[model samples]
Target chain A: MNLFQYVRPAEQKTAIAAVAAEPTARFLGGGTNLLDLMKRHIMQPEKLVDVTRLPLKGITQQGNIIRIGALTRNTEIAEDKTILQNLPLLAMAINAGASAQIRNMATTGGNLLQRTRCPYFYDTAMPCNKREPGTGCGALEGFNRMHAIFGFSDKCIAVNPSDMNVALRALDATVVVNGPKGERKIPIADFHRLPGDTPEKDTNLDKNELITAVTIPISPFSKNAYYLKVRDRNSYAFALVSVAAALNMDGNTIKEARLAMGGVAHKPWRLTDAETFLKSKTATEENFQQAAQIAFQGAKAFKHNQYKLKLGPNTIVQALSVASGLKSV
Target chain B: MNEQEPFCPNESRRSFLKKSTVITAVALTPAAAINAANNHWDEHIAAAIENVSLSVEINGTRHTMDIDPRTSLLDLLRENLHLTGTKKGCDYGQCGACTVHVNGERVLSCLTLAATTDGSKVTTIEGLANGDELHPMQAAFIKHDGFQCGYCTPGQIMSAVACIREGHASSRDQIREYMSGNICRCGAYPNIVDAIEEVQKGGQKV
Candidate 1:
């Protein structure tokens, strides 16, 4: 849209080399989000290395883990037999994202690389610290209904809009990346960064980096996992507050628990405190309510997102109840 | 093992088979005529689009076009190519206003780049008809009155064609879920679902 050059490389190596050669170049995946942002001039890349055609699409199960290729469509990932059986929570999270057509076109890698849907980030006329450091954060004093409630700085308050990343983090997935340096794998929790001092940096990934695949270790707890997303609309919108929960119940007591919150923090919020408290505890409504409170203990809320503080715990309780194979409280 | 069955001459059986074949062939003449007419329409179109070199097979017929890559597949068919049946609503993917089959899969023609789909088959609303006759789904839509504005008819029809093809026309809930991407701002969803149900009831054929 900006009169840029395009290349559809048949191989990933050539595509990587092309991106490395060009200073202002970006890899194009499904183009659902990237192209839209680029057309708005929010993202300006001189070259678009079309990696959609490169043979990087599939979902495979190796032993107790599931490996998802970077270019696998969200719909495909959500509908994969293995994912549906072993990682039902991940599949459910993928299904909870965008509409069918968008999901059909959006890739796993593209979903991970999706920029914040912050109104300030989209509007070039406004000053966004994420778009331009030291400019200002228009969202801080402006409309911040969709902004983060925790792990945010004064410079940026936008919440990460992914539904699958939360489930991936809870399942302790690994993000495999490839670049000029070499290939390396990072834990999914460390894949994204919080808006600490540098709000502009969304992830530790360098500009030249390319995500190859995401490997998820299968957990016995995941068999009972569930993902619940609460949004203003029934479909085609980002989550207001969502929870990914997996719990193992031995009769009435919680054997183990994995929980993560979305739309409440700069990145996926893993509830280690609540999970630690839930282990070996009686899986009752009272226990779930107490655990939910523990999950929200350290949460810092803004004026607009204080509703999430209440909704966050309620969402966690409901998700945990469902994951524990119990009725909603 | 009966002597009468053995005595039944092979000549009579051959004659009966021949007569049935003739009758069946005669009954299929109208459909054959429609197919021939469609072929004639394609050739006539080829004569008009001399400069357009697009090797696209629509509903199954190859045509080479020497046209603008900036011209969207919807525009190429409706405006330049004179297949003005695929309606253009929003010119964006969100509205599902220009949905069509690209390589047997439903895609928003408005958002799709024409150059990127080189050598791909495309199907438009016009291709769904059999000469003067309509496809079963089209007849069902008319019978059930699936549109009010009639502006979103082409896209609705195209999406419906894909809906049936993609095996999503099983239940009312399934139809609603699959057709959620295609919007009829005229608020004719109930009748649209009724039409889809009617066609799907008789075992829809694409």
Candidate 2:
């Protein structure tokens, strides 16, 4: 392992300055993902600024929305009463990710920044555009089952592997970033970027910019939300496919709907087309089937991930139906 | 940067010196003091970039060390201080192999840097034994055959203790959920659950 300097800045300014001074410097949160990547040489920083000690480590409520600090542990959020009651989708999403021990150590921000578990990305020996752009994407042909289906360029096919972000996108949450320019907000849906031509850039946040907090908008919509994750294992595994849906029904007609998908795109895919189609439609089996089909309208699929084209819609429909108190076939 | 109360060093060399002044006078005869100072420096330079002083109370014992800022609590314990009971399975927090108690709450030691845990109470597997007696959870693991190969046992035990503390030991499902982090590839989960259940039930079978 390469040796590096470590600084535990007592103040946030000093920590930011440390990163600004050395662009290769990284802020260490729970180190659940960062240290692992560092050990694998997937990420190597010349300096590590310990950010766990910073005062940005709490979950607070502003009106009906819950603003979670970047440093708040996944375990804390999963167990918080406010999150469980108001945003059960967030709680369910957090619980589905990682294991209990990992949840105890992983911070909210780290989860958002988690890299894909694509074998090609992790094994530097393999050609992965996400890991090293223009090298070519090996997973485009090899083991492409777990790769992306919606936002795939010729260069990369790796999916954005975050259940929490998928849930946040559906709820229309916003990320508060503190960077060289000071405080700014990015809607969660726009926080992560698609792999348009450069798969290397996973997010819009520059290298020096730090995610300060994630603020979910105040809404009663989340009260009827559900996060459904389908994976190979019952525990300690990443999602093969997952859905986050918030459905509000009036009698039998859908009053409102928000849907987002995971394990299917470069970033969380919010099915806005499906939402618009379902708004005034009855929440019956036929209407749900049509809306579900609308969600996957322009989703381009790879050879192996064609199954996700079906699984994605089915997963969303199942979650939405359950949340809407309708029978899921 | 602010002054948090530093815990007095436990019954190690520092505490021994603190308790017995007459013994320290004889024990710190030139050669011993020089050797003691050297040992201190060796521990301090484990990661060796900046001298980060910390007071961590392990088990019931307080230990003061000037650790390297890069030192993880797991590395500080296993690599530098020789508390090897906490295993480093994945080195990542994905596996619960390096679980330990931070202020009586279960935390992944591998993810925690020693500097971040300054003045916090840490309890490792080595500290779970009281002199010649083992902690009830430790004894339960042995009785129930909770391990085969024994790589993840220490972490499993540490997590089990925390599970009981966190009140998840009563239900089978909750125990499974809470202990889901610690994976035993050998598939000894049944025995591990049995052990945790025994410990939760007052550590003695009726």
The best candidate by TM-score is 2
Model 1 residue pairs with clashes: B52-B65, B52-B66, B53-B64, B53-B65, B53-B66, B54-B64, B54-B65
| Residue runs of model 1 more than 4 Å from their true location after superposition | B1-93, B151-153
Could you give candidate 2's per-residue lDDT for residues A1-329 as a string of tens digits?
A: 33445666767677778788775778888787777777677876767777776778788897777899998889898888878878888888888888777777788888888875577988889998887878988987798888787877888878888888888898888888887778789998778988878888888887777788998865666657788998887777878889988887777778899888889888988889999999988877778788889888888877787888888888877888887778642
lDDT score of residue A28 within candidate 2: 80
Per-residue accuracy of model 2 over B109-145 as CA lDDT, tens digit each = 9878777777778889988887998888998899999
Off by over 4 Å in 2: B1-51, B68-70, B201-206
lDDT (Cα, tens digit) per residue for candidate 1, span B1-206:
01111111133433453356433442322223223333453322222211123456766777665553235677777776777777787664667777777776677776564534556778878788899999898898899999998888877887787788767789998888777777888899899999998888888576
DockQ of candidate 1, scored on C-alphas against the true complex (2 decimals): 0.04
| Top-scoring candidate (DockQ) | 2
Q: What share of the true interface contacts does each candidate keep?
A: 0.05, 0.42
